[model samples]
Target: MLKFRELLVQSLLNDKDEGEEIEDEQDVPIPRKNAKSTHIMKKFEGNARQNRKRCISCYDKLQKEKGTKEARAKTKRVMTYCDECDNKPAMCLECFNEKHPSKYF
Candidate 1:
C-alpha cells in the first residue's frame, strides 16, 4: 500500500503548475501547486524525529473513518493511544491529561 506522505507527494507532482508572470497589471499567475507542495514539505522539514512521529490518535481516527470496528470503538470512547504515555501504546488525551497532570505541571 502506498503511504500517505508518498501519495501526497505524488498528487502534488501530478498536478500541473499553474500561472505565469506578467510585467504589467495583467494577471500574474502564482504557482499554487508549488506553493502548496512547499507548504506541506515545510511541515516535515524539521529534525528531531520525535516531531515527525505520527500521531496514533490521528491514525486511529483515520482508520475509524475507513470503518474499522476497533478503531470505531476507540473513537466512540474519545481516546487515542500514544506510545509516549506511561502504560499502553495508546491512551486517550483526556486520560493522559488526568493521569499525568503533574508531569505537565
Candidate 2:
C-alpha cells in the first residue's frame, strides 16, 4: 500500500516536470472582456408596493383621539407609500390624498 502511494506521488510530480496540463474535474471558462451577457439587466426601482407599513395619518388621528400610549399600541398598517414625501411616510389612500393635494387641481 505504501509503495503504491509513493509511485502515484512520483508519477504526478513527473507529469508536472513534463509540462502536461492536469485537467480539473470542474473547469469553468473565464469570461472575455467584450463578452455580451445573455440576461438583460433591468433598471432598479425603489421598494415594492406590496410592503406594509404603519399609516402616519392614522397614527396621528389615533394619538389625538386616544392618547399617545394607546395610539402607539394600536397603529394600523397600510400598503400606500409616498416616495416624494420626506422620510417616505406610509399612509392610507384617503390620508395620502388629504396630505398631498394636487397642485394642478
Candidate 3:
C-alpha cells in the first residue's frame, strides 16, 4: 500500500508537470462513484488527539456556532471549541465574539 500510494502521488506530480490534454472524441459522462464508509472506534476518548487538531481560535469558534460560548463567562455561555480558529462555530457566541463582537447567528 505504501508503494502504491507513492506511485499514485508520483503519477499525480508527473501529471502536473505534463502540460497536455488527453480527450476522447466521443463525449463521455463519467459516472461519479460514491462509497459509504463505516468507522468504529477501538477506544473512545483518546487524549483529544482528534479535537486538539484545531487551534484555540478555531476551537472557540466551534463553541460559538453550537451556541455554547458567551461574551463574559458569568453573563454568557462562552464556547470552548475556539471559534476564531475553527470554521466559525455558527451557533456559538464566544467563538464569534473573538472576531465579530455582535454575532447574530
Candidate 4:
C-alpha cells in the first residue's frame, strides 16, 4: 500500500512538473441552452363550483367587451389550469394553445 501511494504521488508530481493540470469533475461548468418559459396544462376533476374556473383569455375578452363586473358574472368557466402561467390561470384547450404556441399537446 505504501509503495502504491509513493508511485501515485510520484506520478502526480511528474504530471505537475509536465504542466498538466488535473481538473475536478465538479469544477467543470456544464453547457446549457437558454431556459425556455414553458407551461403545463392540467385538468380539474369533479363537478364542484370551485372546479369551474374561468378561462383567462376569454375573461380578458369579456372584460374588454363588457366590463370587469359583467365579465366576472358572464365569462365561461373551464376545467383546465396552466401550472407555470402567471396566477396559474384556468384556460380551455384553444386558449392554452393560443397563449403557449411553443408548447405541444
Q: Pick the candidate with the highest TM-score.
A: 4
Model 1 earns a TM-score of 0.22
On lDDT, the candidate that comes out on top is 4
Give the winner by lDDT: 3 or 4. 4
Ranking by lDDT: 4, 2, 1, 3
The Cα error of candidate 4 at residue 13, in Å, is 44
lDDT of each: 0.42, 0.63, 0.38, 0.75
Q: Which residue pairs collide in model 2, if any?
A: none
Query: What is the clash count for each candidate, in the order shown?
Result: 3, 0, 29, 0
| Candidate 4 structure lDDT | 0.75
Worst 10 residues of 1 by lDDT: 35-44
Q: Of models 1 and 4, which has the larger lDDT?
A: 4
lDDT per residue, candidate 1, 2-97, as tens digits?
244444575678653455322342333334333222211112234544333334454466586775655554443322344343443444454445
Preferred candidate (TM-score higher): 1 or 2: 2
lDDT of 4 by residue, 21-105 (tens): 5455466554423233346798888875779898889999999999999999988788898887778889988888787765223
Residue 12 shift from truth in candidate 3, angstroms: 68
TM-score of 3: 0.16
**Model 3: residue 105 alpha-carbon error in angstroms:** 16
Residue 26 Cα positional deviation in candidate 1, in Å, after optimal superposition: 71
RMSD of 1: 16.7
Clashing pairs in 1: 80-92, 81-90, 81-91
In model 3, what lDDT does residue 103 have?
25
Better of 1 and 2 by lDDT: 2
Model 3 regions lying over 4 Å from their true place: 1-47, 56-79, 82-96, 103-105
> Which lDDT tens digits does candidate 3 get at residues 10-93?
677885446555444344344323211111112223454443333335545456765445422323222233323335332333
